[model samples]
Target chain A: MKMRVHSSCSAAFSARCSRQVAPRAASAQAPPAVQVDDFDFQKYVMATAEKVNVALDAAVPMAYPETVHESIRYSLLAGGKRVRPMLCLASCDMLGGEESVAMPSACAMEMIHTMSLIHDDMPCMDNDSLRRGQPTNHVKYGDDIALLAGDALLAYSFEHIARETKATPEQIVRVIAEVGRAVGSIGLVGGQVVDIKSEGKKVPLETLEWIHVHKTAVLLEASVVTGAIVAGASDDDVERVRQYGRNIGLCFQVVDDILDVTQSSETLGKTAGKDLDSEKSTYPALLGLDESRKIAQRLNEEAKALLEPFDAEKRAPLVGLADYIYSRTN
Target chain B: MKMRVHSSCSAAFSARCSRQVAPRAASAQAPPAVQVDDFDFQKYVMATAEKVNVALDAAVPMAYPETVHESIRYSLLAGGKRVRPMLCLASCDMLGGEESVAMPSACAMEMIHTMSLIHDDMPCMDNDSLRRGQPTNHVKYGDDIALLAGDALLAYSFEHIARETKATPEQIVRVIAEVGRAVGSIGLVGGQVVDIKSEGKKVPLETLEWIHVHKTAVLLEASVVTGAIVAGASDDDVERVRQYGRNIGLCFQVVDDILDVTQSSETLGKTAGKDLDSEKSTYPALLGLDESRKIAQRLNEEAKALLEPFDAEKRAPLVGLADYIYSRTN
Candidate 1:
């Protein structure tokens, strides 16, 4: 793929944050669309991530029973891509909503994501010692505190959205329900259970699809859909956003699986090749690396097509996000 | 105290389900009120518990990902007093709302309570093997699945209430917020953190009160208040229910401490005197047994008084519940 370094920002930063566009030969028959070369995807991701980080920090304070709050703050404040919250904000903005209105729900999405990471890294679960290049929650704080902190964060996610969201009661209720369903049995937890059971077994491709769709895609879908809901998007628009979210959600995981085998641990900030070591099935394992890369490209194209119905400028962040997911090396 | 066993039910059942009343001489200055001689407190408790158990059984099915669902059902369907759900139903009924309207929230309450118990009994936490006369969640399911099950249940609690509740959107939002707060860091998780930290140490009375108030009373308070909110009760009525719940909630824990010291393991359906064994501070430890009993009596009276404004028939279950909390030997 041909990559162009936009000169809108400083040359040094532009070199570090190049936006990669698919080669024109790959989409010869596609409609002429607004060029994404001018969009500063790096600046958009960083700015949204910084806003979410500040909001998260303010949401969970260093309160009494310092250990529990500290444990929560420790993992929550650890840096990440903030892809989910950025998607949320972008979707809301696309639907003509102000950033302030969707900020709580955005923060809530990150809180839930952070909580899953904390619990997933527990001694009884994945048992990882390092996450985001720091000691895992259970490794630093004892398992007991880490467990409570995860529970606290899960509970706080709903409370924060409900209490902090400035949307109408109807909108707030829908957001809560959406976020709740994404985190509940039929979503994250169910996927984790199936994944654990399928370990070391020859799992079918259908089952693998179900696992990733539920565990990862559901929350991403919620993030995008909730942003639209909070902004009072019409039913058609909501459905379009949901489709966009699902395609990219799957694309993100496919790329993640490829990176697990192809990238180094330092670049990933986690244990690379851990999936192969554990014999956990991944897209790259089931399909060849080349095939997985092809699937990701297809998904990115489909996700970007779903955003075509929206105004070009409004959809830039989401469209660029799809490409970002596909082009990420880590 | 004087005891009265209502003969409204069969003699055999009456013998097994006696209702104890405070001696008339104990409250000489109190106004003459509805006679407790006719109210079937045992029948009310049994009937509510049975109904709640059946509802709970129907709420969580043994579906795919059988381990997770079964784990939730195992602890949820296990026979217990179902005091929390009953409090919710009675509170809603008192405000003239149908049981159907409150059933989902009641089930959600049980789910949250069961989740707390499951996580609390994990190996990294309290690490108990027995709960409700059977092996605890971690003992039957592995620690990893148990942890996920707890998370699933907690997530489902909010979802169930939001999706199944028939109340107004405003009321549903309030209930979700209320339940979330009760389960978050400032409530159950917070109390557990402090209790764990203070283990084997001489905690002050104030610290103990804070622990019990946050740990036990908050959920009970949510139970009553949410019920009132769902029924669209006046703000005054909700406040009254909150106060009544708080008083009885403290009474329940105080009596529990007394029973831990006095009852056998078989009678309590779990390990007896475990708190004393762990050197954890309790009401009976901080205050003498006699003094704790006195305090419990005072709390029961205060709780009952809070219910006096409601119609006698409407408040029967709550008043009976307060007395039941006091008189249970187990």
Candidate 2:
């Protein structure tokens, strides 16, 4: 309640102008494990992701309304890197909260992320048929079921957080506000509508960044920021973490763009070169591959620098994540 | 917090079997304006709807993301009966809470209701073109914007409730939980999926009831129940309101089925006889018109009976609303 909820809602967009940071680029090398030698980031990711997967499974079971649940579970559990949830938990951990405190919000982030994917893959939207080495949600469940699955997942994301999160009423309400704003029109859906409209058009560089920032970066920002709020981070701390999230979020997509061109479909696990094949503008398409790589490096570095004032031990996970995103193969 | 959250989620369906209330019928003569002689229920509805419209407009402004916001406002503000918001406010009023206490949530109910309509009208769903006498949301906004508009409206409903409600955090959180569950799988979305699957051919009476209960009745139940919660209604009180809501919710839809056959599209202000046109099962189609009328009357009577324990004057709106649903023409 102490924080400005509306400001947080749009800070992701406004902060972009203030920071004047190059949006993102793409490339990967070995993770800079030296950020925290003893942290064992890889093992932490596996353990945390395991917990997230288990909770997500319980969140939406194969209940009597079987078909929709089946579709929701299919894509939700369809094995991805789970970068968003990990960032949420790690952000919460950095602020000295018990993992359990932010676990529900962390799970909620994945649900929202999963819902977006399910909807985006519909025939009326992106029309992609393959996701995560399997058929897209619409292909498997038909468009209507897939659509309802996404809607249900989106609703449940907020429900799960509101019902399960162990936080103050103020914090819980703020978290819901943040999560809701993150995915609403000005956030994910807004970016998506533009992306749909921009397809096959030679969109300008700013428009492309606007689309990526809103579509891809906003939820990632919400994931980390909501986790921080659940953990009782100060307003200053929350704002700082917001910038970190924004950078990594954009970087994650830029890396996906780079990998789309550089890697094969087999390595990406979904369709590769999808952006290029569809004539969609990406970081590499707009900024060139080498410049995109430099921008990605700068974003990853900026993301890490924002974490400098926090406890080295506590912030190690976040630091490690930026490196991981910058270095991951897929 | 004392009331069971999940129970409210499915209480609309379970209470149906326990009560063995015939799953709604169809007819309306006129609203029983005598429920409270001085109440002037028509004025109450119009006045409450105007307040809700203004609040909804402010809740989502025509911001920078012009297209998506326009799509959201297009269907949202395009005008409808505003039954959900009025029910919410009336319930809150009956429970001795200020109208302002539930106004935001009331608007949210409309927003969620609007989102459903937008999504349902898409080619991937029911594929309608006219709503409230204007082109459907997707027809004007395109399929992508309409889809995203629905998604944004749904998300903002929770955010609006969380940020705008003046209730205690626990109360606000409970409201969020109730609204979320109402629209989630066990609620609205659960019903929608079954409905899509049940389309064409002949679905059993039980299957049809399940769809109506979930798709139509669940959110109405949530509307009144959430208002009761925001007003600090006790668990027993909440359950009482839940039953009343469930009956009236089903009753509302049954009346629509009847009206579909009896009223002209001009009177109904949209496509008439859509149910029969699509071979969709309906109360009148299965139970005969007279039987449907009798059932509608019985449901209205039963809904009123559930409010007998409360003060008559305070509960006047509820009684008036039940009568109004049964007696409505268009």
Candidate 3:
């Protein structure tokens, strides 16, 4: 792919977004035959994740409700991989939108993602005590503060978008509606209910897909779709972006299931094969590891194919992200 | 108070808003000495409550994952007085806006109110067994579903407003910001943390007010503020409306405190004296009952006085609603 990526993470991003000089330098080691610009996918991901983290830290400050804010800050800053936010920023970047315009929404994606994790780890839900290499929100802050922290984060996500996003009111409202549905009963919550209901029971592939599609894929779709919308992409383009997002989202879940069975707890940072212990149906469990890997490969290939119609250089981050999701061990 | 009220709730409201002819008739049997219009406070509340209930029922349908939706419907449709919604409607009505313009926000207020109750009643929080004359959401639905149900309702409230409200997108975004802040850590959840911390201790009067103001009054303020904003009211007028809302909100809490001490569980529909049993500070506990009642009266008067500058006929419902709050026994 034709690309503008370079060694410096912030420099490559700022070259596209900022009026200042593009301090970005193309790789000096490029072969004379091809003169290819090697896109530093890891650096791009790191750069975007840093921006999301900074915005999030400033977004929710410790105030009078110290415990809840402390609780919110704890899980929020708990050092997740920030994959959802990276996807959001990458989509916006691909569509030639400024990082400043999409940063609030990019941070909001992480906030919702964090809230799902916090609530999912509660005693009433999965009851997992560890997440992202640290004690869970409920495990560290106690259930009451943990619940309120999740709720505060959820409520604040819309508020942060509405209050901070430098978009037209129409676009902001659209983003809110898009985001609300992604987390509402029909989206993450719906998938959760089904997953909870189906635990320890015989499950079909379709049902398992439904669980992951809603629980995992829907928010990822929303993250990308919203970024595309904020970038003023046309409806047709947004739909294509949605399909791309959906493929990667499902691919991410398939990879997760594979990792659960194949990777040890030392690498995954949580109990390996816990889903098997709980009898939760997963891609690898339902369709052997090899088949699940094949499905993931198909998903990633389809995801990148959808991006071909866009500018190849500008779409490098998303293409790289899909590859990262497919190849990562954890 | 010179007023435009009549026997029928729909008639009285329609007279002010719809182009349809006002079938509203002034009281034929007005006292000859004063020639006063008797605003039927009961019918206005009942009528507005009916409208809010219909909107709420239409807002959340039982789609997939029936359990969460059922839990949401249970607490949402459970017969509270619909006080928050009525206050929202009353604010819009007083500002001369159509009920249709504000009805979605009106229902949204109740959605938020219901969410707070659901979260507050979980065993990790207040652990209440009964609410609005029925079992609490967590008591009826399992804790997991109950938590998700509350999360769903809270998420849907914003979606409903953004999707359904007919106002300008700016107005809707502003309303979302307002409502979101009202429920965030520094709003309802903030007050809740303080309340929880203060339990089984001698909380000061100031601390008690702080708790109720955040936990209770913040949402009330948002409810009225959102309604007025959707009605196209100016900032100064909205602030005036805000003052009126704050007074009524504080008054409602004080009366709740008094009833907790004076009323029985059977009469008040829930465990009335449970606040005392938990050693939670209340208006009557911090101040003598006589003083607390006097404060409610003062608050009610101040609340009504703020509405005096508006068209007397237009403000009748709000005036009557404040009076109803003051004189209410349960």
Candidate 1 lDDT for residue B186: 89
- Pairs clashing within candidate 1: none
DockQ, all models = 0.77, 0.70, 0.70
Query: On residues B80-147, what C-alpha lDDT tens digit does candidate 2 reach at each position?
Result: 77888988998998888999999999999999999999999889888888887899998998887888
As for candidate 2, its interface RMSD to one decimal place is 0.8
| Candidate 1 lDDT tens digits, A1-330 | 221223343332222223443432335655433355576766776778899999989999899889899999999999877888989999999999999899988988888999999999998999999898899999999999999999999999998888888889889888888888888778889888988888887698889878887788888899999999999999999999998888888888888899899889897788789888898988989988999888888887788877776776778888777777777776
Candidate 1, CAPRI quality class derived from DockQ: medium
- Scored against the true structure, residue A7 in model 3 reaches a CA lDDT of 31
Docking quality class, candidate 3:
medium
Tens-place lDDT digits, model 2, residues A168-199: 98999999999999999888998898888888
Tens-place lDDT digits, model 1, residues B200-289: 988999899888888898888889998899999999999999999888888878888998998899978888998999999999999989
Instruction: Supply the global lDDT for candidate 3.
Output: 0.81
lDDT of 2 at B262: 92
Candidate 3 C-alpha error for residue A100, in Å: 0.8
Enumerate residue pairs that collide in model 2. A25-A292, A25-A296, A26-A292, B28-B327
Tens-digit lDDT track of model 3 for A1-330: 324333322432222222211222334542121111367665667767777788889999889868888999998987777878888887888887887888888889899999999999999888898786688888888999889988888999989989988888998999999999999999999999998898998799999999898999998998898888888888998899999998989988998999898889877777688899999999988999989988887887678777776765677788766666766666
Candidate order (lDDT) = 1, 2, 3
